[model samples]
Each structure stands twice: as C-alpha cells, then as structure tokens.
Target: MPKPSAVTEAPSVVGSRLRQLRQRQGLSARELAHRLGISPSAVSQIERGVLQPSVARLIAMTDALGVPLAEVFGGPEQRDEMPEDLTGFALQRFGQGTEMTLESGVIFRRVSPGRTPGVDYFVSTYPPGSAAHPESGMFRHEGYEVGTVLSGELTIDFDGERVVLRAGDAISYPCSRPHRIHNTGSVDAVAQWLIVHPER
Candidate 1:
C-alpha cells in the first residue's frame, strides 16, 4: 500500500518559508492575512517563528501563497539555532514617568539599552490628544523600520501620506522616508518596533 502524504513538523522552518513566499509574491502581512482570513498579528506571529499553524491553516497558507505544502514546511536551511544573551541590560522600568515625552501624551523610548541606536526602537503608549514624538523632527535613519500596533491608535507619516493604524495592524516603512509617528486617540495606544543595524 502507498503511504499517505505527510508534512513534517517544523515550526521555525515553515514560518520562515511562509514569509519568504509572501515577500516573493509582494504581499504584505496585512494583505496575506486578508487573504487567509486572519488578523495581521496572527500572520506576523506565524512569520516570526512564534506560532505554528494547524493542518487547516497550513492548507490555507499554501493556497494563498500558491506554493506546495511540502515547500511550506520543508525549508530548514537556516541552520541550528544559537544561544541568546540576556545580560548587559542597564535598566528596565514601566509606567509613563520613565518614558520619553514626545508630546502631551506621546511617549517614545528604546525598548532596551545597548540596542541599535539609530534603529529608533520603542514601544510607545499614547493617550488621547497625545501625538507621536516625531511630530516635528520627522527624522530619517538608515536600515528598515517595521512595527505592529498591538493596541489603540497609531499613525505614521510616510513622506507625505498618513497611514492610520489600529490594533493588530502592522507597517513597514523605509527609514529613508523621513517618517514620523502620531498617536491620535482618546485612549491608550501601544506598538512594538524592530530596527536593524550593524551591531547590537
């Protein structure tokens, strides 16, 4: 008797390949999620090696990406995972007082010390009437900037276009766009950012 087709379990590899397919198709996470009938956060988590999809979801992903199921779960080519360091953190705190006040209710801050400086890393929480810190600076930086609005309201200025974002939304903006953030809400807003640079 012939054996049934099987899919190996590889959360990391599958997730990475899924992202690769999305990029090749020129589809953003939001776009992919819209196709998959899931939230962008779900797609982001799946791509970041955080969440593994079920059999049904795997079929959906393959169909949406127009790829074979084997390809989705088959690429483990990245290499063995390396150990991560959790030291050298100078300080860590919570609450609005310790964060940078960009505006009346906007707070900007680096998620951790010794992170990529020009990366402009942060998890800002903006209250009503609060605006993002870059209201005036509208600075430019090297590398890429990607962020996910975990909650509340957020806005990003890309050149001259304003993209208003809500909870579970994500955005990828070129650091060369002279962009800035704005928190226009009557409630608290929060988002996480990731920036790439030469070294830690």
Candidate 2:
C-alpha cells in the first residue's frame, strides 16, 4: 500500500498554522472570531486544537487571512515563493481579502494585495454598538485617512468635534488628531477606507 502524505489535516498542525497566521496579521482571537462571524470562545477552542474547523470554516479563514489554501496545509516551506507578478496590479475577489476584527468589533478587510508603500486600503464594517476605541476614547496614528460610509450610520469624533454620517457620506482628516468612531445605529455599518502613511 502507498504511504499517506505527511501533510495530513491534523488538528494540532492546523491550529498552530491558524495562530501563526492570525498573529502575522496582528489580529487578536476576538478579532479573528468577529471576522469569522463566530464567537471568541470558538476561536479559542480552534486555536488550542480543542475543536476542528469544518471545511467551510477553513475556507473562510484562509480567504480572510489572504493566503492561499496550500499555505495552511503545506506548512512554512510553502510560503517562501512569491508570485512573479506580486508587484503589479492584482484582483481580489469578493469575500477574499485580508481581514481582521478590532477589539471593539470593527472588521477591516484589506482590499489590496502586496505592499504599496505608505498606503493602506480597506473595507471596514462596524457592528452596531461598536466603537473604534474603548469608551470611544481618542487615539492618533501617523497617517491620513479617508473613508465613506456605504451603509448604516457612523459617528466620528475628531479633535473634540463630532459628526454623524450616513450612506454616501465621506470624511477625510489627518490621523494626527485624536479621533474615534462609533456605530450609533442598530444595523451593521460598512465603509471603504484609504489611509496614507507618512513617508518614513
């Protein structure tokens, strides 16, 4: 009889891979759970190898992590090779982007592939009652952000000023200002964002 492939779908291996990928993307367990549309506890279980992910869940996760499915199964050796066209234009499919959930329940999905230097583009979702920071406290980063609400309501507080936005509304400001965002509506809010980082 032929020997089985070493790359079996072992729960422990999968869990380790999952954890590594999540950390590489700077996501917490809660954030990954939110992006997966599952509970944090479930993510904990999955990471600890206490639970096995279904095929569908695995697919969703790989898509969210912005990695090819093979990377998850084939281990680290598989990641060393890059596509020849990585620096050029690329297409990201619907439901296929690097996604992470914030501690406050905000989901950010990177729409662009590879690094463009000084730019980050994303599609973000703010669940009802979610805030950009705990207690909607002010925070600052070294960049400029522009975003437009696609649906539902978004409240932005910047440098002591507050504004309510609805679908089709857009805002752009320097991230140097202390700012926070809140989802003040009962429905999920969606937005598209483009952030430009100061040249290093």
Candidate 3:
C-alpha cells in the first residue's frame, strides 16, 4: 500500500490517540457513551470525526481522557497544513448547523468513511453568536475531549453555568454534563477538537 501523506496521516493519528486513551481506561464504546451521557453511536461518530462535536462535547471527552490540549491538537501528525484539494474527501461549510436553530456560519469536516484514520481529526468554524444545542432536547458527549478555540468568543455551557472563552482558551469537561456551545462575539469562531474512545 502507498504511504499516506502528512495531511492523510492526521485523522489516523487523532483516531489512534482516542483508541489508546480508551484502552488505558479499559472502557468500551458503549460504556464510555453511557459515562458521557450520549449514545454509543455518538461515541463512534466522535471517534471517527464523521460529526463535528461541540465545544461542550470536547470538554466532556477531555475530562474522560484526562489529557491536555497539546496532546490533541499539538500531536505530531496533525502538524501538517490542511490540504488544498484534500483529494477524495470534501469539507462542507454552512451558515446553519444541525445542533442549533439558527444559521451561524458553522463549518464541518467529515472525517470517517471519507478518510482513513489512526484517530479522528476535524476542523470546524463557528461564527460569532452561533451556538449548538442538544438535538430535540438531547445533549451530552461520550469520552474525554479537548478543544482549541481559534477565534472569536466561545461560550462553553455546563448546564446553566457558562464559561466565556476567548481566542487561545482551551478547555476540558466531563461529557456527562448537560452542555452546549455558543459564539458570543461579533466575529467568527473557529476551533479544532479531539475526542478519544476505547478501541472497538
């Protein structure tokens, strides 16, 4: 098989990170999901990055994994710049998102089924004042997660208490909390996330 390039290597690296963390904790996907207050499917999705997890979800995953920001985004394989064409895969950008009721210029990248992974990797943007809620009253995450806010104001919601985060603010939270994310500034919000899960 041909060796994957650096850009292609990132998702796998991210996936591997999650798998390793999950193994360290000796937890199963279903078990982690239960602990994170989300469904196993969601856990699977996060591990694959087929879905963009909210800032709230990232915190929950990081709490579960017990790792720090540098471990997630600063990991070696992720150091490559995003691909110009990205070959066979594609990224979708929208003014609206599925997690919330309004269009907020959110950008999402589909990681799994589209790309091979040693771990999950995603690049997403949240416009100022854009936020995400649990689907139809459902909320929560599935494992230890981490996030690096790239721009604007990020509001991390833990139940009703809110943590207003700005550029360069990093966070870790337990997935079991009722959480949500909102862009509370006048500019666009961009962030990268990593979530880990037990090996399948």
Which candidate tops TM-score?
2
Candidate 2, residues 31-66, lDDT tens digits: the string is 888887889998888777787664235545755665
* Cα lDDT tens digits for candidate 1, 93-147: 3431123332253444445433223344556667765554323556554457688
Over 4 Å off, model 3: 1-104, 110-118, 134-138
TM values, all candidates: 0.43, 0.58, 0.44
lDDT of 3: 0.55
Q: Report RMSD (Å) for each prediction in the order shown.
A: 20.0, 11.6, 11.8
Candidate 1 lands at a TM-score of 0.43
Which pairs in model 1 have colliding backbones? none
Give lDDT: candidate 2, residue 146: 94
How many clashes (backbone N, Cα, C below 3 Å) per candidate? Answer: 0, 0, 21
Ranking of candidates on TM-score, top first = 2, 3, 1
